[model samples]
Target: MPNIQVSALAPSTQVIRFNRPHARNALSLALLQETATALHAAQNDDSVRVVVLTGDDKAFCAGADIKEMSNTGIPMWGQSERLLAWKTLENFPKPLIAAVEGYALGGGCEMTLLCDIVIAGQNARFGLPEVKIGAFPGDGGTQRLPRAIGKSRAMWMIMTGSLIDGPKACDWGLATEITPAGGALARACEIAQTIGDMSPIAVRMIKEEVLMTYTKSLDESLSLERKLLLWQTHDHNEGIAAFLEKRRPVFSGR
Candidate 1:
């Protein structure tokens, strides 16, 4: 059976679900490759403005596949398809959202952190348990965790390998929203639809600029935002014209 499932929840939103529920959707090398391929397809499709990643009701992802990892070593240890898949995840240009329900541990937690928006079911569980396994989270966990939660909190979680629930995840800023159990996916789709209703160019630039905050200085980022607003964006012109005309803006994504 296929390891990943893709569906169109909306004209502009693509939902990718991890299908390995028996394993709590543990991210195996093959599963990651399938996910990467799906992401690449979504990235190339102009009609796909937002992507929502999720898993079955049992779990968003348990972590790396234990059987595979124990036998083969780390999944993304070096230059390989796994590493490239991670790179694709980190560099996805459009907005990506995560709808986390159950376990999102270790590499799974890191993947959630990679998303632009994270919606979690109140019963969702998140952690970095690799330290207990005599390994550390290697797939953006150390870096992204600190960025999501504060340094000290991230340090505590990483060092102790403790799990946090959805409410706590939101309180610590790791999750963007907390929904009732089983409502995360629905809420994420709702948010994605709202984003889809916006101008595609605006949505893409907003994602790009927000991600730039990590690599660029505030002044540099501001300057870049200003340049785009003044000269590079066609949507802004349409927005202003529509406001003056008292009509809805029809964006061409130019």
Candidate 2:
């Protein structure tokens, strides 16, 4: 079987599963390329409204494939593919959810942090132990972790090479929710479905607006919001009308 598997959980939600249990679903170069390809496809497909990332066996991911790294000496092409995966996850317009269980370490943790939301199983453990190996988190972990979990916590994780359990991860804001054992994937899919049921244009706009907070000026931000809502499409009108009627809005995604 392929190292990665893709399936549709619902008409509007796609699930990507890492299947290399022997390596603890480590981020091998092949896995990185496939993940980027999958994300690119899902981003372009209107049918795929939400993307859920999960893994087989007990590990969400064990970070880089150490054996491969030891043999290949970190090929430049491999590094580029990995970076592409990181960017794809980080910039994905649709909702991205990580269902993390077992261990999410180093690059694994970086991958989870890129998701718009993270749901962890009770047994999940997260860390960035790059320093232990005389390296640093190069796959955007240094930049994104501080933004997600704050400077102090990210510093502690990176500097000490310490790992945090699921509960601590949630408390530190690294994970949005914590579920019972083996429930992370289910919860992620549920969250995805909830988001998928919303108006597609509004969902995309919301993502755009949230991403703008990091770099855009106040004027530019406000202008984009105004411009996005000015579409005045049938779906936009339906959203307003449903809100006025005081009932759940059924979005046709026009």
Candidate 3:
């Protein structure tokens, strides 16, 4: 089997699984490259409506593959590769969800944080433990972690390298959902399917609006919403008709 497994869960959903269980699904250069390739492919494929990133077996990811880094000698190349991988996930146009189980530490946690949504197994653990190894998370960790879990918590996690489990992650809004053991992927897929069932154009617009609002003041967000809300005019009639008739809304994606 390949180090990374990419498979379709539905006509509109793609699941990419990290297969390096022996290494706790660490982000080796090859694995990061493969993951980026998969994300790139999904971005261009109209058939794919949602993408779920996960790992096989017990561990979600144990961070960078130390063995590969040790062999490479030049750390900058590996660092750059992982950074690219993080950027790919962060900017993926379509909805991305991380289905996390076991450990999601260091680079793993960074990867999960980049996704639009995250579903974690009840036993899943998360942290940025690079400090323990005489380094810090370089792959968008300082930026993404604070955005997700707030500056204080992100700083504490990075500085101490302490792990927090699923419930706490949910409490901090770092995780979208927490499921029973072996249920992270399933729950993630359910959310993906719900998203896939919606109108793609509207879905895309909503994502755009939310991202824009993240940096904008409340007044600016409201002002921008005026422009985007007009998109509803394209399909509002069909949506209402379909809802009243008790049928599926066949969006034209206008």
In what order do the candidates fall by lDDT, top score first? 1, 2, 3
Q: Compose the digit string of candidate 2's lDDT tens values, residues 1-254.
A: 68799999776999999989988998887888788899999988988999999985489999988666644565432466666767777778888899999999988898887788899999999999989878888787899899988999889999999999999999989999899989999899999999999988778878889889777998999898889767776778888898999988878777
Candidate 2, 151: how far from true, in Å? 1.3
Candidates in order have lDDT scores of 0.90, 0.86, 0.85
Clashing pairs in 3: none
lDDT of 1 by residue, 45-145 (tens): 98898999999777999998877754455444564878999999998988999999999998799999899999999989999999998889889899889
Q: RMSD in angstroms, candidate 2?
A: 2.1
TM-scores for the candidates: 0.95, 0.91, 0.91
RMSD of each: 1.5, 2.1, 2.3
Judged by lDDT, which candidate is best?
A: 1
Cα TM-score of candidate 2: 0.91
Q: What lDDT score is found at residue 252 in candidate 1?
A: 78
Q: Mark the regions of model 2 whose C-alpha exceeds 4 Å error after superposition.
A: 70-78, 245-248
Local distance difference test, candidate 1: 0.90
RMSD of 3: 2.3
- Index of the highest-TM-score prediction: 1
